[model samples]
Structures are given as C-alpha cells and as structure tokens.
Target: MMNICIKTVLLIFLSQIPVCFSYAEFKTDCSVPQSLNTKMILFSVDEEYSLYSPEVIGLIEFHFKEKSFINNVIQSQYVFPGNYDYQVIDKDLAIISIKEVVGNLVSKYQILLVCISDIQGYFIYSLEHGERMPNVHRDTGLYILR
Candidate 1:
C-alpha cells in the first residue's frame, strides 16, 4: 500500500511540472555567426547606447550550456546630436574593456579594447547653444586580437 501511494504521489508531481509551463517550444530570433569579422548586430536600432561600444569591447563570448561564442554588444557610441563623429575624417573609434565580472566561472568574458576613431563626442558645453547639437555617425569596427 505504501509503495502504491508513493508512486501515485510521484506521478502527480511529475504531471504538475508540465502544467507549470504551457509553452511547448522555445526559439530564439537572433542570427548565429557564420564567419569572422562579419557579425550582424541583433538590433541595430536598439544598440546605440550599449555599454560595450565598438572598439573597447570585442571578442565577446556568450556562455551557453557547454560552449561559448563572440558577439557585439555595442555597435556604435560617442555621438553628439548636432555634431556626429565621422571615422574617415576623425580617425577615432570607441574601445571598450571589460574590467571584471562577479561571476567569472559562469560567463568568463573579459572585454578589452580602445577606440581608434578620433574622439568626437568628448566635448564641453557650448555657451551660445544650450541645446544638444548633432554629431556625424561613422561606421566603426571593433578590433579583437587572436
């Protein structure tokens, strides 16, 4: 009798697990990497102010169940509204470095890069214009060493 009761209880517990989550399938819309130096930023529109910037951060590795891969968190940064920074002319890029992380073993990702593009957005407030001005946007690439 005890054995029958235990089995019945265990069966009930296992069955309840499915009702906990109704979703049957899990899917991700992000694209996977196909080649070197050619990664499509997940959401270009949403990547303006990412902390990773272009150069300072590269070789970004994501920790999956057992493996990891590189990814770009910040596609662009260092821009002013009225005066956008153009790389061809300015020759400066933002480089992102990962100082540290609390959980290194779990996600072991350390970012270290320097922006080679000219410092465009590093500006002081203008006395004549209180409103934020426009800065040019230039295509910048992150450099990661092997």
Candidate 2:
C-alpha cells in the first residue's frame, strides 16, 4: 500500500512538471515582446522644450514604400496661421522652421529632426530634453508627427 501511494504521488508531481515548464515558457514569450515595445516607446522621445513657441505647430508625415524601404516620401503640414519652411536632411531626418508674427515680434521656432527611423525601420520621435510623449505606431509604413 505504501508503494502504491508513493507511485501515485510521483506520477502527480511528474505530470505537473510539464505544466510548470509550459507556463514559464508562455510567460517569457509574451513578456519579451511586450517589454521590447515598451522600451521602444520610452526611448522614442528625443526632446522636451519647456518654453516652446505657441504661435505655430508643425505636422509632418513620412511614408515608406513597401518592400523598397530606401525610397520614402515626405509630407508636411502646419497648424495655425504661419509661414513655414522645411528641408529634408536625408531619408529619415528633416528640419522645420516656423516663423510666427505676434504683435510686431517675429518669433522663429526651429524644430530640428523631430522624428527619425532606425535602420530596421522603426520610427522614433525626437523630443526636446528627453520628454516622454505618447506612443505612436506606424500605419501601413507611414509615420505621422504632430
């Protein structure tokens, strides 16, 4: 009778061993990818400006071609009434200059390379003073900035 009891306990423990391993494996798989995405979001903010010009805000978007990652298209837009100018530094970098007229004071806000992408094609926001911003994902290889 003691032999039978010991066999039963051993069988139960052995059966649970696989369950524990499977649970641990599943947890690691899910956690690894989730943590990577979170880190990407946290590292995306490149700058934070406490005293930013309130006159004009710029909106920019980058569209990456499918399969041909080297070829990208850029589109720029402005929020509020202002004279804006932009220059593409490269495929993934740009400089935006905004001129706002407020009460005879012409304020020029230079937003340099507000966003950039990695070699693996991940988009990150370039913020001032390492400010944290909302996580933004690409839509069909298009990244939009506001």
Which model scores highest in TM-score? 2
Those runs of model 1 whose alpha carbons end farther than 4 Å from true positions after fitting are 1-11, 19-30, 40-146
How would you encode candidate 1's per-residue C-alpha lDDT over 34-139 as one tens digit per residue? 2213222221221234323322332222221112233434434321111111112112222221112223311112222232222112211112211212221222
Hey, what RMSD does candidate 1 come out at? 18.4
Superposed Cα deviation of residue 88, candidate 2 (Å): 0.2
Residue range 30-76, candidate 2, lDDT tens digits: 11111111111111221333333221222333221221111111222
After aligning candidate 2 to the native by TM-score, how far in Å is the CA of 66 from where it should be? 27
Please report, in order, the local distance difference test score of every candidate based on alpha carbons.
0.26, 0.31
Q: RMSD per prediction, one decimal?
A: 18.4, 16.0
- The numbered model that scores best in lDDT is 2
* Global lDDT of model 1: 0.26
